[model samples]
Target: MSPARSDRTRRPVDLRQRSTMAGEASAAEAEVEMALDAPPDPQAAAFFDVDNTVIQGASIFHFARGLHRRKFFTTRDLASAAWKQLLFRVVGSEDPEHVAEARASALAFIKGHTVAEVEALGEEIFDEAMAARVWPGTKALAQLHLDQGQRVWLVTAAPVELASIIARRLGLTGALGTVAEHEDGVYTGRLVGEMLHGPAKAEAVLALATRESLDLSRCTAYSDSINDLPMLSLVGEAVAINPDARLRAHARDAGWRIRDYRTGRKAAWAGVRLGAAAGAVAGAAAVGAALRRKR
Candidate 1:
């Protein structure tokens, strides 16, 4: 077998044995009792979605912005910005395929760069650009759970590489994000794992819970979109933050906690969310105004 494949196959086994075991051992002495205690039939987790559910807007948007600023995307994103405007103007539905394709196109655009460079870029994107973009209340809520000793996790459709950077920065446990397929230290412009969206997010969360020995009944989940219902349905305490109409209605009917952070533009709709405000995140301005002209 090629050395790369042999290495990749062995790395996970090694990582799991070392990393997960170390994490379990380290967290063992601390109060994991939150997952154990509670009334009979305890729910044992607090799941947070990235991209508008935890951060100010779509994590992808900010990451894309960062990449754009660094000269990653082609002229196509701008060209598509126009088409997005027109599509939303006329049809009111941003095609999912287009969304995925755009993401693939973007990832493909940056394929050959080293993971370290991407991580470095991500560091700047999170700290300098998106750090202040968190919503005032969301961070507090997440901290409360962590302080209470409950495990906090970020589950998103973002690429794991990008999501892990943000998760580590925020002191969250880890992220289960969309896996962009990699081949010999390169991106393949396609997903290697499940796209953690909608029902998929719930699936991912549940899987993590099982792996981590977490309890779902005692767990809490926060989100801003109807699309996140897959995640919200699996838990007892679902907090809706700055919810859209459909999710708002669901939150109201289900008696979910609805919190708002946006200051203005409260109407039937305010176009497709370049970002959504949920958890501790607020919308951030796009990245790369400097390189926008180049594209």
Candidate 2:
């Protein structure tokens, strides 16, 4: 086997072992209990990817927009992030550079900020920017799992704080997300580990399964990106929701279930619509300026 493939295969085991040793596995289970009052489903659970799978767009982008509106960052920063967001929306996949840039920017802004402060703002941001963006179909699927007495968790590359807020609002069991380290209630501008993404996501699921006493053969996972193949493959049942081209093709080859919520027209016009919206905003601003000059 190629070295890269070999490493990918072994990484999950390493991560699972480390997380169990660090007590994070048990902590993840505790978070689920604290977040929900439902009866335990020790043998099965569901994992959902957050970005395009559960919501209409990238969750972190919306959170960043909210932070910009709150004056947490400059307009130049927002413009840069907006470009990346546009690319993600158009391409429907993660870009490593864009992800790194976003992580660095987020950490920079939250440095020295209290955890409570960020969590409080995350709550407001979710209400303002994220709640309305949730895909009704995806929400229904999650609800279906909940109805079946299975614990549902969101696995995303977004910060744990934001991910948890989404879970609580959606009435899910909990979430697994990239953890930014903090000390004495304040952010240290460093992550506890790598972002909960790709293989890392699979590792998290494995650790959580071990802690929660869940059977991998009974668990299901849903996602939109091919990057999540590790996580999806680790589970017994995998569903692709609004998947990108690569994932759609892979799912077909693998015989996994696929669900596309976007109409053909909607998918084709997504980038055009975003461009038109930006033009409209600029036109409105110009018209307002003209009126002010007349006054």
Candidate 3:
């Protein structure tokens, strides 16, 4: 053989060395993938409603109170807000007209306001007013789900900023709430979509489950009003917390669990009556004055 051919024949193939390097590269690639993506939790989540479900009263009532204290609007404005809140608490969020009016009012209230400023105010107000009012039973249930390595998400029709503050204070995973549109940092007096209510909540949860690769059959949902029936039915476990009369009846008929944290039905009704009366009185006076001024 020629000298070049002899040299090529003398070169030995290091198969073991080549294999080791290839294996190392594959292992490194897998490590990088593992670092990039987290494994999805096999366990499911628990969704909790705010307002009468987690707390004793409407959350927006507290928020409005805070805004009124800060002079974000006048007492007349507060009266209008109080009237809307009373309707929400008494009649529930089922009326489309009321819903539209509430949406318009909320949009106008936050119009031109900085999102960060509103969120900061919400957090401060929550700590001062809403924190101490959380129902021990509902809160314990939420903690139980957390202890079980399941995620707990607050589902509400409230603003996302307020919902986030509540979830963070309670050490929950996150929240799904109504999205108010904003430009730069200020609210544009518009919503990105429909308010997170009724069927919208179920849709939001379904989307969340799909995104997280969750098994809806293992999830739980809790709510207080009949309007949330769609959301409650979407879950494997449905719990009615401080349910209204309609919801209580529906829960009984559907064989869902019911938790009434109120001391007594009569007392609860009495409290609602008192609040409604106060709001009506203030609202009537404000409307009367406004009409007189117009004339």
Candidate 4:
């Protein structure tokens, strides 16, 4: 099935608009007009964070890798993105600077590309890289919401086109994500507002809720990172799935439902093994340099 067409109206909500109640309300009404064919439950819906919550890794990182393979960017750009992905995996959260850099890089790469072109590539990339990476446990949770007649929307920091593809492929309601500004069907290489992250996520959810006439107290939200606290806090039921250290602690204190799919010992051992491998590679490089110097 083709991805849901939310990106057609996926414009970013300005944070400054929240200063006035009238402005905020108007912005909410204008921002979200998701073309979800699913009949919403009216009172409730579920919002899920994409990275590490619904998927095993960062969706945008995977998408970037796919784009790099498609000759969208250079090897150096991919290396930089890979490093950011590694940091995200190790730390289990996002850094503002890293997010900004990624946003800038993404815009630079897609400048002048038509929205249709990117969306088409996104479909292929999703099948190639994102489909297999979805967490079954989290997928089940999203399915449960669907079974209960609630709309399940993937709220992510990834581009709305990619997020919408994942949502459609997974047979969910729709998605809300970062909006890249485009004009006359081509990318302008600029953002409408800011990336859909941190507090901005909460704002998007609020706007979406207003647009869809959803009750915040009846809604549920799931996420893995502490960066999504604002979003998690906005809902009536907050679930922490494979939560980071900070989010786990906060979830415990707040009495939120915590679901960890990863085996703690196994994950720790994997990290140790990765560190050991890096050390070994460094040692080999050092030995090679010493031998060359002696020669």
Which residue pairs clash in candidate 2?
none
lDDT against true structure, model 2: 0.68
TM-score of 1: 0.70
Q: What is each predicted model's overall lDDT from 0 to 1? A: 0.57, 0.68, 0.66, 0.66
Question: lDDT by residue for model 1 over 23-44, one digit each (tens)?
Answer: 3322221212233444232235
Task: Report how far residue 262 has shifted in candidate 2, in Å.
Answer: 1.5
lDDT of 1: 0.57
What is the C-alpha lDDT profile of model 3 across 99-190, one tens digit per residue?
Answer: 55555555644556577876776788898889998999999999998777777888876766677788888888777776767789887767
Q: Write the per-residue lDDT of candidate 4 for residues 234-272, one digit (tens) a residue.
A: 999999998767788999999999998876634584563
lDDT of 4 at 242: 81
Q: How would the candidate models be sorted by lDDT, starting from the highest?
A: 2, 3, 4, 1
Model 2 stretches with alpha carbons more than 4 Å out: 1-30, 34-40, 81-106, 265-295
Residues forming the 10-long window of minimal summed lDDT in candidate 1: 278-287
- Candidate 4 to truth, TM: 0.74
